[model samples]
Target: MNWALTNYERLLDLVWQHTWISGSAIALGFALALPVGWAAYAMKSSPHGAVRQLSGVTVSLSSVLYTIPSLPLFVIMPTILGLGWLNPINVLIALVIYAFAIMVRGVVDALNAVPPSVLDSAAACGFSRGQRAISVTLPLAGPVMLAALRVVSVSTVSLLSIGALVGVSNLGSLFTNGFNRNFPTEILTGVVLTVALALVFDLLLVAAGRLLMPWNSVVSAGGSA
Candidate 1:
């Protein structure tokens, strides 16, 4: 605690850097996942055999990509992107790829869970495909999507520390520094702060979900209680 308080400024900077990296990755991953997930969901039900197989291929590909070891991926990012080894962009891009892999499958599952009857009703009420997707389908799928997003948020926060291993400053630096110095206090501080950061992100996501989907809050309350 004394160490943390004495180095409060440094700790705060690490926290901010971690937040920026994790938040950006989550945002970019979701942006990229939406269309791909939707396409996978849409294509899986297609009459064409080859087109239907594409969804399975995509899900498999994402899984394979995710299985590549994170440390190696971080180290290899510079080689792949033509960036300097220590560039934060390498870490940022790696995290985004991971988030996308995790969330894209979730998006497919969430969209699949939407009721066909609801979609038919929306169509009957004169909603076009785009309009229905924006107003009806997405809203109906929001709870599931939110659940997936919360997972991504927590996972990203936890993983952002790995960037420190590659010389991109973040909370994980505390781990390496503490280990080198044989300082248990610093290592424990890092663990506590990392978990706390992940929890904060999880709580914020839950609050946002409740605000955006009040009915879901009611359902969850009733179901849990």
Candidate 2:
């Protein structure tokens, strides 16, 4: 802690870079996930079995993207994107892909979890497809979607650390710096701050979800009663 305090300014700069790289990727990933998730859910809900097959295939590809080894991706992203080897943009893009992969499937599952009766009720009310999706489906699915956001945010923050191995300046750089100097404090600081960031982000998502959809809790409580 003393060592960290001594170098607190440097640490703050790294934190800002780390947060920017990871947070931007997460934001982009979440934006892309909405449509991908909707497509998966829409196909699955369709009567055509072949169209349903596409949904499974889409999600499987996302899972595959996530399973790729991170170090190699960091190394190769520069060549693939024509960027400098150590550019933070490479790290950002890589994290975005991973975040999108995780959230897309999660969002699909959330949409699928919407009760059939509620869907039918929405339809009976003469709700158009767009209206039902925006008003009824997304509102009811908020809990699960927010749960996905929590997981994706944490995962993105953690995964972005891997980019530091290739010289991207995030919190993960502390591990490298500590190792080179054989100083445990730097490494420990990284671990603590990274975990703290993840926890804070997760809690914010939970709070936002509850605030945005108070009716969800009310209905859940009534259902239990």
Candidate 3:
């Protein structure tokens, strides 16, 4: 408590750094995943044998990316991306890769969960593929996507701390510093702050989802009643 209070400004800076890295990675990953997931989902049903294989290939590759060890990935990012070892972008890039790998599958599942009957109705109503995707399918998949985003948000927040291992400063630095100095308070503060940050992100995501999908709230209320 004494150290934290004395170093309050430094703690706040690290928290800000952690927030930016996690938030940017999640946002970028979600943006990239949407179209790729749609492509993979659409390709699954293609008449061409090779085209249909694309969906499986895409998902398998994403899973493989997720399986790669994060520490090594962080260390290698500088060499791979031509950034300096200490550059913050190294952490950002590594985090983005991880976020994308996790979110792509979620996007595919969300899209697949949309009812076929609803898609057919959209088609019958003369909606083009793009129109149906944007207007009907996406709205229907909102809850599932929201669930995925929440997961990504929390996971990214938790994961970003690893960046500190490679000289990239974030909340994880506290852990390393505390361990070196044999100070439990610093380590506890890091753990508590990390957990609290993840929870805040999750709550914000839930609030945003409810605000954007009032019908989902109504359905839940009706189900409970």
> Best by TM-score, which number?
3
Q: Name model 2 segments beyond 4 Å from true.
A: 219-225
lDDT of 3 by residue, 1-225 (tens): 888899999999999999998899999989998888889999999999999998999988997898989889999999999988999899898888888898889889999999999899999999998999899998888899889888889888988888889989999999889899999999999999999999999999999998988888773434544
Clashing pairs in 1: none
What's the ranking of the predictions by lDDT, best on top? Answer: 3, 1, 2
Per-residue alpha-carbon lDDT of model 2 for 98-211, expressed as tens digits? Answer: 899999998898998999999999899899989998999999888888888888999888988888888889899999999999999999999998998888888878788889
lDDT of each: 0.90, 0.88, 0.90
- Pairwise TM-score winner, candidates 1 and 3: 3
RMSD of 1: 2.6
Tell me how many clashing residue pairs each candidate has.
Answer: 0, 0, 0
lDDT of 1 by residue, 134-158 (tens): 9999988888988888888888888
Off by over 4 Å in 1: 219-225
Cα-based lDDT at residue 99, candidate 1: 89
Residue 181 of model 1 has an lDDT of: 99
Error of 2 at 84 (Å): 0.3
Query: Which 10 consecutive positions of candidate 2 have the poorest summed lDDT?
Result: 216-225
